[model samples]
Target chain A: MGTEDDVTPVARPGRPYDRSRDAQILAVTLDALAEREYEHVTIDAVAQRAGRAKTTLYRRWPTKVDLVLAAVEAAGRPPEADELPDEGTLRADLLAVVDSPWLGGPERRLAIFTGLTSAARSSDRLADAVRTTVTEPYVAVYRALLQRAVDRGQVAAELAPRVPLLAQVIPAMSGHRLGATGEPAGREFFVSVVDQVVLPALAHPPGPATPA
Target chain B: MGTEDDVTPVARPGRPYDRSRDAQILAVTLDALAEREYEHVTIDAVAQRAGRAKTTLYRRWPTKVDLVLAAVEAAGRPPEADELPDEGTLRADLLAVVDSPWLGGPERRLAIFTGLTSAARSSDRLADAVRTTVTEPYVAVYRALLQRAVDRGQVAAELAPRVPLLAQVIPAMSGHRLGATGEPAGREFFVSVVDQVVLPALAHPPGPATPA
Candidate 1:
């Protein structure tokens, strides 16, 4: 995932790369990924689809893995803490989080994720990129929202310590739904998970914590 | 997934397929699947690996899809309703469900599942096979266990209608964990999900049912 500074010609000795075209190239990369598996995605195809020279993509991202990682990173930038919705209630915030277009909605996001499935298993870098760029941020946002609810006395203070574990429920379920069914989990499904599962789980009085 | 009757020679007009050997071939199919992506698995390779003639395999399962489907079905036999654990409590039943060596335990199951990721998207039959063979049975077991708890006066009766929705939480979360991290969700993770998410959600008092 390169920023403008990484592509600026000052870092390289040769030709000046057109920084403005990076977004288009990345978008095409994602499209290529969405349409095919990771092993099948080639930098050559990406360049041709983006209507750019091979050298241009190579100068920035040296390998297919690099390009895919960058495209995924760009397509799913992690939300800043302040950028998350503060809807005054955990349920509202959780609902808003899923509704936001973080990775071009659930359909496109699932396509992109499925595209990287095989590669991620073998490539630690790709796994880390997906975890850090896509999964971790969502989990963090949920955790923060849960903590916020506890602080507001909407959720029980006794459950505050369990916030970290509870935070992963919605994201895990959403990801699982997408992976297992090969269908995007829509707003309705998200609402059900929030209302039926997450909200209810939060409502439970803390039982004696079992140490694993 | 096939029963013993499927391989018996009574139905076929040609050479008698070794009904006993069908299990060995299916096991090899699963091994192949666990080792490689669906596209990469070949009947020739499976025959070689299993020390059987290619024609023999073709006689039994005509195509790669057919063989893979049969293998998956064989590997993951859906539990009969009565076969599920009735451990007196819903939590114990769920823990038992996860702990049961269903699909050869979590690690092999995850490997087998990840191997099918790409093909499942395009092949409706494969998708259905996975859903019916793997996902549906687990969901059903959880649902039954939850319903039993309601019947036994352990879980709240108000939550009875929510059984179907609540049942999916553990399976969906487990599936998500496997897909995202490419790791087997072991007993410890399963216990956490049950205690921290499933049980808590079950404990929550129902609100006015929101219509989708």
Candidate 2:
């Protein structure tokens, strides 16, 4: 439904690319994703919401996948610092990740998650974006947490390789539930994951170190 | 792409609804979903692939979500017997579910999964289909397995309510990995889930009957 009438000039040309407008487009795009399902959302809708031209959005992101990926990559900014406060045991540390505002809790995060999975299934750009922007940073935090647990003798050294995949579990589970209900998973759901899944996986007894 | 030239007209009315044509449509739809990502896939495309008119396919399923849901429900028919061989422990039972041919292995299953998750985010019909066709049955089998584990005192009786969510863990993990790599998670990935995630979550020291 893009018409010339719908195309608002994004400021006269040569007037500094207006980085704020790009940010505005990304923000509206994310809001659109959160408010509607991926397939139902359109770039025209985003442009309308952002008060920009469809041509302006098309110039930056040629397709919906490109736009969605840019938004997801934009949303997944690494926390300013890596060293978390000593949250006592590994359970608390892991729980802190879940409890954190950023780690897959918000409605917008779910939107990015749903879009990422759908796009990454076919697009290499999104797949790489998922790996670099979403996967690696999350895994790094998990690895560091598990190492701390190992040093404290809470988790076994043998479970090292397996710990990284654990990083994906809670987010995946939350993402799964969110797809159905369009709401972030509750605290109880996360508590079950930590109490039942993560801690259980790592509770290797101290005797006869069985290699994981 | 759907054209009268390509259309294989369904048998005229009063004759049985071409049951085989229905099957062909479902099969081609599944193929279409696997061959392309969810958004790019269309009813016309599926109809074209099945060599049937779009009207014929539309008669059976009104919208793309309906068509996709039908294809998913068709793909996920769990053969009626549920009495699993008691593999002596919860670990073995869980492994059997993961190892089952119908569970987490097929390309069509992944396609259905991707399509369902993508569509379900907004459509209640797709969401319910996913819960019933995709999530519940799998959860039922897992609940049965865990029940057996509890019967043998291998699992904590207190963890019953949480068991169903645990059932989602393996499929969710595999789904996440599949979305990125577009490949079914290998045997090793399922194994890690059972060992590291499920087992640990249920690992209660066989001491007192402490209620969870």
Candidate 3:
């Protein structure tokens, strides 16, 4: 097993570099990850595939977890608020998100989660980095989309306030599908959750029902 | 590293045995897990603590993952449907599940999941065993409880049918809390998820909104 001493050294300020080296390294990491599980993917292998020196790889990432996280970060673009579709409804926007190739794909989500699980187990700093870099940004984009729907009266006003619920449920749904079936997420999964589960709970405000 | 040969032997039909030996062994397994993370909880240590022969332990379980999973199984009783509180309300029944001492405690749940993560990485057999023995049974209880509530007309009739949603979301919520906070799960976390997230999602029947 490689240890802390195996980390690559950082590049010096004066050295000339290939501009695409970072992308090359990241692409190699994804390919290796897809081919094997997280534990099997190593810095040496990534460097070998990228055709870059091990020292150069280490110069950029202090640990293998860091390298894997960087690769995960590079795998997909974060969901953007402006990119959200306006079908004149909150449900449509949610459908759009669930249906998007980014959230819906199995391999892509698994690749990201594999890095996350490794980081969560091995190092606290890496765990925090993953949360901020991968989890939070996507959650923020979803929340903003929901908030926009609320502002437009597409959804109830009170619905926008429950950030934690959306944050927790969406990922849980995806993770559950992955854990059980290892299949890509689908729009019906999200729509069922939002319509059959989320919407009804939100429809009635948080007070006692009126007397019959 | 104790390999496959390190396992203790199982009890045979003709063998003289201590009736309390199984309990003692399981207790030692829990103690070892609590003191050390799953990776460090060796069969040797468990054998030493239980004053049992290594071959005996190995005979019972061929792998460390099996041993650890057995310990988790012995730690808590399966949730029983008869034990569920039925106040004739969906919220109340869900809240009872949320507040279940076995499910709500962080250390126990975390330890169980830690073992699961390791098993998921190392052995497919262990993973399947865990899913069948632990996850499936617990889900069955919850599903039964929901079915009861639906029959009572407390929850929407259609809401009880989404097994995949319920099966995935509840554990995912608990796992997410443990991953994020590194703390025990609490009643508030469970209540918020059920009321704000799960109940609403379930209560809402899936449909397209009428053109406003």
The 10-residue segment of model 3 chain B with minimum total lDDT is B203-212
The residue-by-residue lDDT of candidate 2 on B47-146, one tens digit each, is: 8878889899888888888887767666654431255746666676666665555523444455546655556544567768877776666666776777
Candidate 1 shows a clash count of 0
- Candidate DockQ values, in order, are 0.38, 0.33, 0.40
lDDT of each: 0.71, 0.65, 0.60
Sorted on lDDT, best first, the list reads 1, 2, 3
Better of 2 and 3 by TM-score: 3
Q: Candidate 1 residues B98-126, lDDT tens each?
A: 66665575566556766665446446688
Error of 2 at A142 (Å): 1.9
Candidate 3 docking classification: acceptable
Candidate 1 structure quality by residue, lDDT tens digits, A103-201:
576566556666665456546688778777777777888898888888878888987766887788777776667656666566777777777777778
Displacement of residue B136 (Cα, Å) in model 1 is 2.3
TM-scores, one per candidate:
0.72, 0.67, 0.71
Task: Give the lDDT of residue B69 in candidate 1.
Answer: 84
Instruction: Name the 10 consecutive residues with the lowest summed lDDT in model 1 chain B.
Output: B203-212
Each candidate's B-chain TM-score, in sequence, is: 0.81, 0.70, 0.68
The per-residue C-alpha lDDT of model 1 at residue A29 equals 82
- Pairs of residues at least 3 apart in sequence or in different chains that clash in candidate 2: A196-B201, A200-B200, A201-B200
- Candidate 1 Cα misplacement greater than 4 A, ranges: A1-11, A28-67, A81-85, A99-128, A148-154, A204-212, B1-6, B9-11, B28-67, B81-84, B101-128, B148-153, B204-212
**Candidates ranked, most accurate by DockQ first:** 3, 1, 2
Q: List candidate 2 stretches off by more than 4 Å.
A: A1-15, A20-70, A80-85, A101-131, A204-212, B1-15, B18-71, B80-85, B101-131, B204-212
